[model samples]
Target: MPSLSTALARALTVTAATVALAGVTALPGAPPAAAAPLPPGVVQLGDGEPCPPATLCLYRDYGFSGPAYGIGAGYAIDLRWLPMPGHGGPTAADNVSSWVNRTAGVALLIDEQGGRTRPLFPGQHLEEPVPLNDTVDRVVW
Candidate 1:
């Protein structure tokens, strides 16, 4: 038999290992988690209206009326992974028609071909982007 101190140390080590993995469980068939949600301090916007202070808002329809996504300033997003709720499981990519940028810098809409639209200035909003509609693949602000 081991010494009393040695046995106690071994038991303590086992207890520590168990506690370290207390809440971890195996994910058998879970899909990869890569999509991210908007940060805090966000709000919904209306047609041709400005975003809330330091916020960026994207709209699926013109006039900010359908399936809006809002985020705080200082964030760059890949719209391909942003799931659009109530849209039959489509993404935000190539579906952003109108948006409002309230950050200090401009918001650039990048297309799938690495093309970028004109700068969307801070505190500015577009209700209907005739050429840019359904052309945005990503957004950097």
Candidate 2:
């Protein structure tokens, strides 16, 4: 049987896709955190080195400054097997703080507890995901 998160993720994905197809990225006066997509071509411009084209970079610190574990486009990676960068835990499973999505499509952020929480579209990023900080376990591209 699928997990609670799996079911929730499927439902949310469909809803998000439907909303995106309807050209309704956000509601009137909705907070930034409530919406996933800001606008087409909306990139999160911040500090730190630029991410390479066709890759998703997950940083260990805010402002994009820290050791990054980048996954190339078109792949799903489990964080438990990867060690976190300096000044962090043993694994990247719950240590990432920010991300830069340079892949061709949206990247799904799955929490360490096996929940697919949200999608980070291409060129979208959060300096610090308040609700998602240090909880990501998988990157589904």
In TM-score terms, which candidate is top? 2
Please, what's the RMSD in Å of model 1? 9.4
Model 1 lDDT tens row, 51-70: 56777788887767677777
Name the runs in model 1 displaced over 4 angstroms.
1-50, 85-89
Compared with the true structure, the alpha-carbon lDDT of candidate 2 equals: 0.70
Local accuracy of candidate 2 as per-residue lDDT tens digits, 1-119: 99999998797777766776786765344433343432222223233667878878877788777666667776787776565545447666788888888888888888757455678
Predictions: Cα RMSD each? 9.4, 17.6
Cα miss at 23, model 1 (Å)?
23
Off by over 4 Å in 2: 1-47, 85-88
